[model samples]
Target: MSYSATDMIFDSEGYHQDFLIDLYEKLLKPRLVEEKMLILLRQGKVSKWFSGIGQEAIAVGVTSILQEDEYILPMHRNLGVFTTRNVPLHRLFSQWQGKINGFTKGRDRSFHFGTHEYKIIGMISHLGPQLGVADGIALAHKLQNEKKLTAVFSGEGGTSEGDFHEALNIAAVWDLPVLFCIENNAYGLSTPTSEQYRCEHLADRAKGYGMESHIIDGNNILEIHQKLSNIANDVRENPRPVLIEFKTFRMRGHEEASGTAYVPDEDLAHWRERDPIVRFEQHLLDRGILNWDWAEHIKCKIKQEIEAHLAIASEDRLPEFDETIELNDVFKVTENQYFEISGEISEIRFIDAISDALRLSMRKHPNLVLMGQDIAEYGGVFKITKGFVEEFGKDRVRNTPICESGIIEVAAGLSIKGMKAVVEMQFADFVSSGFNPIVNYLAKFHYRWGQNADVVIRMPCGAGVGAGPFHSQSNESWFTKVPGLKVVYPSNPVDAKALLIAAINDPNPVLYFEHKALYRTQRQEVPFDYYTTEIGKASLLKEGTILTIISYGAALQEALKIIEEEKIDYIDVLDLRTLQPLDTISIFASARKTGKVIILTEDSLFGSIASEISAQITENCFEFLDAPVIRVGSLETPIPFASILETNYLPYQRFREKLKELIEY
Candidate 1:
C-alpha cells in the first residue's frame, strides 16, 4: 500500500508563520553557503564543497524536532543539518578554505567534521560508516540509561553501499535507539534512484530488519517538522531504531565545480519546481502567516548573520598541535575516581586474564560484545572468549567468517553503529593479512572523521614453544606507526587483565597485543575485580639505581629472569602496556635515572619497537644517558619450524644478555 502525502504530516503541532519560516530559512542556509563556497573553490581559495541544495527540508525540519543533546551523524550533503545545530557559519567557510581554524582543523575534508558539545557526530567520507557509529552511540546511551537518540543521515545512493545494509541490519537486530534518515533526492551524484535500487520505498527496507519505518515528502517542511517531533519523542521514550525516507529532489549538481552533465534536463526541471525551501515558504504564506517583505527581511538577516559569523570564524585560531593528545588513547574500567584494582586471588595465565577482563567488562556494562573467528561457540582458538557465547548469546558473541579483512571491516562497521566489538585475529602472526583494514581504514577512521571506533583487536602475538613463524611473530610495531591506533602489550597477568578492561572501556580503536608465549606459560596471581592500566603510562616492575631494562610482552619475563640470575640489585624494569601514545614520560624518567638503557622485543631487530624507542630516547634524554641505548630482538629471518631453530629465532634469552652488556658498557 502506498503512503498518501497527507499521511506523512502531523497536524497536532501548530505550523505557524514563525515556525514555518524558521524551517525554510534553515533549509536555505546550506544551499546559499554551497553557492558561495563553490565560488571560493573556483577561485582556488577552497579545494572542494559538497552542496545540500535539494535536501534542505529533510535536515532542517528533522533536526528542528531533536534536542541539543541528541546525536546526529550527517553525510556529505547534510550541511543544512549542522546549520540547524548552530554550527558557526564562518567555521563552515573556513573548512572549505582549508584553514587551520576550519571545522576539522584543516585535517579532513569539509564534509567530515565533529563537535561533541553539540552532540553532532562527524561525517564519514565513505557512505555508511556513520550508520554503524550512530547505533554504537545509541547503544551506549541505552546501556547508560540516557534518553539520547542517535540519528544517522545518508543519501538515496548511499543506501546501495554494503555498510548501509550491515548497519541497518545490526541496528534492527540490536533494537538500538537510532533514527536512520535517508534524504532521497531523486539521484545519487549522477545516478538516478531507480537505476541504483529496486526498492519501492527505501523505508520499506526497515521491514526486513523489523524496524518501524515511514516515507515522507522531503519538500514539505511542516509535514517533516510535525512527524519528526512525534517520532523523535517516541524514540527517546522507547529507544528503538526507525527508518525514515524523505523523498526529495536535488536542485543543483553534486558539487559546486561540476556542471552536472549527467543529470537529465527534464529531471532537473522537475525537481527545481519542487524546491523544498520555496515550497515551505509558500506553505507559510498560504496560511496568511508570512508575507513577501517579511520573508525578504528574514533572508537579509540570515545572510548578515552568516557573513558576521564567517568573518569571526576566519579569525579564530586553529586547534593547537598538543590538543590532539588530549584524549586518552587507551580506555580502562573505572569504578570511581580511581582505577578499580584487582588483587591476586589465584594464579592466572595470560589467556585467563583476557577471559576474565572480557567477562568482567560485559558483566559491568551491558553494551560490551565479543566477536571474531570461532569466538562464539568455539570460544576462540586461545579460549580468550571461552564461555562468552553461552553467557551473552550469539548476538553479542558473534562467530564470523575467516575473512580477515571482512572481520575487521564488519567490526569497524559495527563499531560505528554503537556496539563495542572485540575482534580476534586468531594469532598475531596472521595479523599482517588484516593490516590494511587496521592501518589504512579503521586506524584512520577516527582521524578522518574526528570520531573514534572504540573497538578492541585481540591479537595473540610473540614467539615461543615451537608454534613456528606462521603462528608466532610479534607485529605490533606495524600498527604503532599509524597515528591514531592504540597498541597495548601487557607483561604480567594482572596488567593484562587491567589493560584488556581498559581497551574495551576506551572510546578508541586499540590493538590488544597478547603474547602467545605468555598466554599459557606465564602465571601470576590476579584480582577478580575489574581495573584499568593507563594506556600511555608505563609500570615500573622494579626500581633500581644503576641500569634500566625497557621491554614488554614476553621480554619482561626475560628481564625478570636475568635480574634474578645475575642478582642485579640496582636494575630497573619497565612494562610498556600501551604504544602509539607511548609512555614517553616514564621512559625518559627511567632513562634519566639509569643513565644506561637496553630495549628489547621478540620481533625482528630492524624497525622493531626498540628502534623507535631508541630514537626518541636519544632525542629527548641524550645528556642523561651514559651510553647509547642497545637493543635485542630476533634476527631478520622467518622464524623456523623446528623447536631449536624457533628458540634461536626468538630474542627472549638474548635480550637478558644484551641488557647485562648495556649495563657493563
Candidate 2:
C-alpha cells in the first residue's frame, strides 16, 4: 500500500522499479545489441547504421506503459521501442541485413522497420516527419472511439522540424490522445542542443502549442516509467496530447562511422557517469530488487538471444516474390482495343469517366467513405456522389468543412486504422488548399517510412462544360509527379469501376480524376457483380494499323467515335486507368504495332500527360516510330463560363479532327 512521492503524485502505484529493471534487462539490453549492430555495419555485415545509445531509457520506459494493440511512431533511433512492442527480432536484424525477411521485404533499409503486424506504425528517418503521422493515428483512434493511445518518439533535434510543429499544433487543436516523447540527448549529429535551440527544455516548446509539458530525468528508469504511465492514462481519459522531454545523452556518435571529436571532454565524462542502463542496474541492486549475479545473467541472456536471432534472420528465407508477382501498383491500365459496347450510337454524351466510377464504386463498397465540400448532402455540385448520403449513412458519407488540409489529414488518420477514405475536391482547381496534406505529407510518408494510406482523392477535373476555368480542369499532371501516389483517369464506365475498386483497395495513396463534364453525360455497361480492375494496366479499345491513339477519361470516347467514323486502319486505342505505373509495357507494345503515336487528353496541350508519354516513347521506341509523336488537347486558355468560349478553349472536336488527319498523314 505504500507509494513513493513520485508514485503518489502521478497516481502510478502500479508502476514499480522491479518492473522497470525487468524491462531494462529484457528490452534495454536490445539497444546495447543494436549498438553492436553499428560495428556490424562497419564490418560490412550491414549497409548503414543509426545509433541510439544514450536514449534507451526513454524509448523502453515509454513503450512499457502502452498496451499491445496501441500504436507508436518511433523515429530512426527508437529500435528499443520496437523491441519493447514485441516486434520480431529476426525481422529487425534481417532489415539491417537488407534481406527479404526484413519488414519492408527488402524494399527499404533498416530504419523503416515498424510497419509489421505488431501494431507499431513504423519509424521515419526524415527527422520529425513521423510526428504528424502519429498525430493522425491518434486522431483516428479518437474518432473511432477506440481505447488506444499513440506514442510518438523524436529526438531533441527533430523537435525543430516544421512537421513537428505542424503535428503538435494540430494535436493541441484537436486534443488528440497522443504522447510526444522527445529524447533530448544534447547533440543532434554533432551540433549541441544549446546551439540548435534557445529553450532550457524541449518540453517547454509544448506550451507555445497549447499542450501540457513534462521534463523527465532520462537516466532514472523508475521516474521515466512513472511519468510516462501518468501521461498515458491522462491522455486516455482526456484525449489530449502531452509532451514529455527526456534529458539524456548519446553515448555513441550520431551514426555508424561518425566521430565525436568535437564533443567536449567534461560533457562526455558527465554523460558517461549517468548512463541509464548502468544507473538503473545499480538502482535495482541498491533496492535489493535484483542481485549483481542475476543482472549479469540477464545481460548474458540478451546477448545470446540477439546473436541467435541475428543468425536465424540471416538464414531465414526472404518473402517469396511470387506472392507479389500479381501485386501491381494501383494505377489505371489500358487493355484490349476491341470495343466492348455493342451496336452503333447507343446515346453518347461527353463527360469524364471519373464520375461514373465514383457512382458505381459507392454502390459496391459499403465501408467506402467519401467526404468533401457539398459532396454528401448536396451530392456534390458535380453530382458524382449523388444519393451517396441517402444510401450510406452520414457517418460513412461525411460532409467536411471547408478545410481541405484538415479533411485529408483526418482521412489519412482514418485510413491508418484500416478504413478506406475517398475524399473529393469540388474542383481539381482548388487542390492548392490540400496540397500540403497531399504532396508534402501523404505522398512522402510511405516512401519515407514504408507505410500505406488507402485513400482515394477524387478531383472533378477538365474544362469543356462551360463552368469556367476554376470549375472545369484536369490538373492530375501535377499530382502524378509525386512517387508513391497512384494517379488515374478513367476514360469510360468500365475503367472507372475497375480503377475505383483498385484505388479503394490500393495500399498506397490514389488520386482519382473525375472531369466535371463527365458527371452525368457518359454511361457504359459495368457488370452487376462487384469486381475490381487492376491499376498500372491499360485497356486497348480499338485496333488501327496506322497509329496508336492513346487517351484517357473523356478523350478516349472521343477518339473511339472518330476512329469508327473515319474507318482508321488498325488504330490501337489505349485507355490508361492509372497514370503512375503508366502500363509502359502495354504502351510500348501498342506503339510498336502502329509505328506512330498520338496522345490525346481534355487538359491543356502544353506540358500535359501527352508530353510525358511522347518523351518516354521517343526515348524508348524511337526506332519504331515512323512519325513524330503527336498530341491533341485543350488550348492553353482559361475556360470561360460562356458555352461558346468554353468550347473554343477546350479540346473536343478539334482533337477528334486532328487524330483523323494524323491517321491519313
Candidate 3:
C-alpha cells in the first residue's frame, strides 16, 4: 500500500509514539553526516561521498529491528545503518580520511570497514557480491542452529547481476535465514530504473525463486520499522529467505564526483518533496510527538558530535607502509607448521585423492562446508564428491545453482564468520564468470583489512581430455598474477592430497587447480592419513647438474616421462606445487647448479606460468646460465574438441623436442 505524509501510521502497539521521535532523530544524524561529508568532499578531506539522503529510512528502520548479534551487510550509502550499529563518528571520519585510526588502517578510503565484534560487514566496491556473502553467513547460522538472521543491502542496479539471482535461489532452495533488501533508488549511476529492468517491480523476480517478497514505502520510517521487525522475527523463527524491495529515490548523484545532470529536474523535485527525513520529521510534529524545539536540539546535538569526531579524525596519523610484509603474513598460516600423519598408504586416482583430502579435512574441522553445482546429490560431474552427502548430510555438502559469482562470494562470507568453505567450480573456465569476487573481494581481504578469507576454490583445469574451450582450460596463470591469492597445481596423487589439505588448513584464499585430464588417468600411492605439503615450496622430483626442468599440474608428467625415456642423467625436475609464491630460492639454486633451465606448463605459450618461471630464473641466475631460459607450453588457441586437433594443440612430442633442445644447448 502507498504511504503518504499525512496517511502514514505514527503509532503502533509494539512501538510507542515516542519511538517516532527517536527514529526521526536517528534519520537526521545521517543526513547531517552526509552534508558534512559532502563539504569534506569539496574541501579534499574525503575523496568521495555517496549520500543516502532520501534512503536513510531503509537503513535506520531495518537496523532498528535487528538483534545486537545479528549481522547487516551494508553498502556505501547506508550511513544510517552504520550510525545505528553504533559505529563511532570519528572512526567513520577516519576511514573517509584514510587515517591509521580507521578500521581499514588507511588501506582503503571508502565505505569498506567492518567489525567482527559489531557483526556488521563493510561493502566492497562491487555491489552484488554481498548478497551471496550474506547467504553464506545465514547458512553458517542455520548449520550452527543459531537464532540469528543476516540482512544484506543492495541497489536496484545490483539486481541485474547474476550474483543476485544466484544468492536468492540458493537461499530459497536451502531455506536460509537471510533478508535481501533492495533499495530501488530509480537509478544505477546515470541509468534510470526504466532502462535497468523490464519488470514492473524488482521484488516480483523473487516469486520465480519461490521466495516471499514485499514492496514497502521506503520513505515511511515508522511503517518500514514495523514491517521489517515482523519480517525479521519471522525469518529468525522459521528460517527462510525473503526479498524486500524498498521503493525509494536517490536525491543525490551516484557520488560527489558525479553531478545530477542526467536526472530530470521534475523527477528530482518529486523525490525532494518526499525526502524520508523531512517526511518523518513532519509526521512526528503533526502527530504532536515532537516539536520544533526538540527537533532543533536533536539536530544541534548530532551536528556537534559530527564536528567533534571530524576534529579528532583529522588529527589521526596516516599509515606507514612496511617493507617486511612476508608471505606467511598474507597466508595467515606458517608454512613450516608440522602436520602429523596417521593412515595407511593406498593407491588412488587424482580426483579421488582430492575427494579424500576434503573428507579428511571436513571430519577434522566441523566448520568446513562444501558448495558447488550438482555436488551434493549428483556427487559432482566427475564423482570427486561421490557419497559426500550421505556422510556429511545436506547441511554441510550443499548443491548450489549455476552461479559462480554467488558461490565464491558465499564462500567468502562464510570465511569471514570463521567457517572454512571449499567451493568447487564445475569447470575451470567457468571461473571467468565469477572473477570479480575472486580478484576484487576474496583475494584482497587479507591485504586490505588483515582479514583472512579462509576459503579454498577447487578449479578442475587442463585440456588434454578434449572437453573443448568451455570445460577444459588451464587458467592458473590468470590467478598467479593476483597478489594475495595462493595458486596451487599438483602433479601427482600424493601432492594433490597433500596440497588440498594444506590449502584447506591455510588462512588465505587458495586457488587449488585440479587437472581434469588427470582425474582418473593416473594412480599413485597416497596416504590415507592427514598431511600437508608446504604451500610456497617446490618439490625436487629428480636431481641432476646439466639442466633444470620446472613444471607442474599435467605438464609435470610429460617432463618426467621425457627424462625417463631419454635416460637423461643430467636433468633436474622441479614440481612447482604453488605458483604465486614461486619457490624462487629453490629455483635459483637449481638454475645455478644446472647452468640451464626449461619451464613447462599446459597453458597457452603467451602469458603462461612457463613465461613467469623463465623470466624469474633468468633475472636471478642470469650470470650462471649456460644457455637462454626456454619455455614449453600449449599452442595459443582455444582447446579443440576433436582428439586429433586437441593432441596437435597440446603436442607433448613437440614439448619433448623443446626440452631436448634446452638440455643440449
Candidate 4:
C-alpha cells in the first residue's frame, strides 16, 4: 500500500531542531555540488556528472539514518549518500576529476566505485544485478548472526530487470535483512513509467513475492528520513526483506550530455515547485528553526567548501599507469599450499575428485559457502552433493532458485566481504544465464576497484552424452577471451581436485570446466590426502621430437588412446591443464623441438581455444616449425542428437587423421 509520513507522529525520536538543520545541510550540499559539477562538465574539467539535483532527499534521508557499518549499494546519482556518510570531500572531488586519489585510481569514472572503508558498494551500469549483491551481503550478515541490514537502491526503470525479481524472491524466501529502495522519478532514460511497468507503484510489485512494501513522498526530506529510519531499524531487528518506493522526479537530464527534451515542460515545472531541498528549507522556516540569514549563510559555507575541494582536486595529477600497475591486481597471486599425499592411493573418478575438493575445502575454510539449484537435499542433478546439506547444514549448502545471475552476483558479494563461494551450474550450458554477472561484475571487479572476486563457477560441460544441444557444450573458449578470469579444463581426477582447491583459494573468479563425458569414463590413482595444483601450467604427457600434439580435457584422453593403439609414440603430447594464462613457456619449448604441432579439442573449430593455440604457436615458433600448425575440433553446425550424426559431428576420427598428417609433414 502507498505510505504517507506526513500524518505519522515521530514521538520519542522527535525531529529535533538540530536534526532538522542536519538533514537540511545533507540535502543542500549535494544540490550545490551537483550544480558546480554541471559547470565543470561544460568546461570539460569533469568528464561527466549524473545530476541528482531534484532527487537529493532520498540519498540523504536513507543514508543519514543507516548505521555507519551497514553497507549500502548506491546508484550513480547517489552523491548525497557519499556526502551524508561523511566520506572525505577531497577524495570525492578527486574521483570526479579522475585524479590518482580517486576510489578506483581512474580505472572507473563517475560514482562507479566501491570502498570497504565507507561501507559502500559501487553501482554497475546494469543496475539490476546489484540487487542480488545486496542479497549476498545480507545473507552473510544473517549467517554470521550479526544484527545488521544492507540497503540497496534502484530507479523505477531498474525494477523491470530480471535480477530485480530474482533478488526479491531469494531475499524474501531466505528472510534476509535488506532494504530494496526504489526512487520513482518516472523515467528510465527516455522511457516513461507507462512503458516501464503496468503496476501503479514499483513497491506494489512486492506483493506477488510476499514481501512487505511502502511508498513515501521521495521529495519530502522529513517523510523520507522518518519512514526510512523506522523501516531500516525494523528490517535489521526483524530479519526480513522489504521494499520502499520514494516518489521523486529528476529535475535535470539523465546525464548532462543527455538533454531532457523528451521530458515535458509541465512535468519539469511540477517537480521544481516540489524540489526536495526547497521544500525542506520551507519546512524549517515555517517551524522557526531556520532564518533567511542563517540559510544563505549555510548555502554560502557549503559553496565555499565544495569550491575549495574542487580546486585542490583539479590540481591533482591524473593516473600514470605502467605494465606492472595495469597487469597487477587482476588476480591475487597464490602460492602452492597443501599437504603431500602419501603411499596410500585411492582409485577415483573425475566426479570423485571434484567432490573431494569441495568436501575438503568446506571443512578447511569455515567461510566457504556453496550455492546451486538442487544442491541441498536433492544432492544436485548429478548427485555430486547428495550428502552435502546433511553435513554442512542448509546455511552453507544453499539450494538457490534457477536464478543464475543472482548466483554469480551473490557470490561476488561474499568474496568482496572476505569470504569464498563456489557456484555449481547444473549443466555447462546454463552458464549463459549467469554470463553478465560473471563477465561484467566478477571479471572486472578487481581490475576496476582492486576488489578480488573469489568465486569458482563449476561448469559441468562437454558433449558425447546425447544430452542434446542445450545440455552439452564445450564452450570454454567463451571465457578464454575475457581478462581477469582463470579458465581450467581438467582431463583427470588429480588435476580436477587440485585445481578446484586452488581455484577456491585464488582471489579471483575461476571457471572450472569438467567434461561430463569424462566424469565416470576413467579411473586413476589419486591422492588419499590433500594436495594443491599450480594454475597456468602445462604438463608433457608424452616426450618425443618427431611431432607435437597439444590438447586438453576429454580430447587429450582420446588422443592418448589413439596414439597408443596405433603405436605412434614418436609424437610429443602436451596437456594444458589451464586454458587461460596458458603455459606459453612449455608450449613454445615443445613446439620448437618437435617443429610440427597439432592443436585439438572438442569445441567448434572456428574461434575455439584450439584456434588460439594454433595462432600462438605459429606466431612464436614460425622459424622452428617445419610445417603449418593443424587444428582439429567439432564441426561448425549445431551438435546433433542422433548417434550417427553426433559421431560424424565430433572430431574423434578427424583428430587422429590430423595427427598422422602432421607427422608426415
Q: Per-residue lDDT of 302-397 in model 1, one digit per residue for the tens?
A: 778877876786687655656535343222223322476645478888779888999988888676767677888888887778878778877677
Per-residue lDDT over 1-665 for candidate 3, one digit per residue giving the tens place of the 0 to 100 score: 34444554455446676666677778888899999888878888888888889899999999989998988999999999989877899998888889988888787877886788678888888788889999989988988889889999999999998889989988998898999999999899999987999998999999999999999988888778878988998888999999999998898889867989999998888777788888767767776778999899999999999989988997899877775654334556545655766569999999889989999998999999999999998999998888999999988998888889988988988888889999999998999989999998888787677778988999998888878989888889889888789999998999999899989988889999999878898899988888988888999989988888888988898778877898787678999888978899999999999998888888887887788888888788999999999887888888899999999888577878977787667
Point out where model 4 deviates above 4 Å: 1-13
Per-model root-mean-square deviation over C-alphas? 6.1, 6.1, 1.8, 1.9
Cα deviation in Å at residue 653, candidate 2? 9.2
Using all chains and alpha carbons, the TM-scores for the candidates as numbered come to 0.74, 0.77, 0.96, 0.97
- Best model per TM-score: 4
Q: What is the Å distance of residue 597 in model 4 from its true position? A: 0.5
lDDT of each: 0.76, 0.73, 0.87, 0.88
lDDT for model 1: 0.76
Better of 2 and 3 by TM-score: 3
Models sorted by TM-score, best on top: 4, 3, 2, 1
lDDT of 2 at 395: 65
> What's the lDDT for residue 299 in model 3?
94
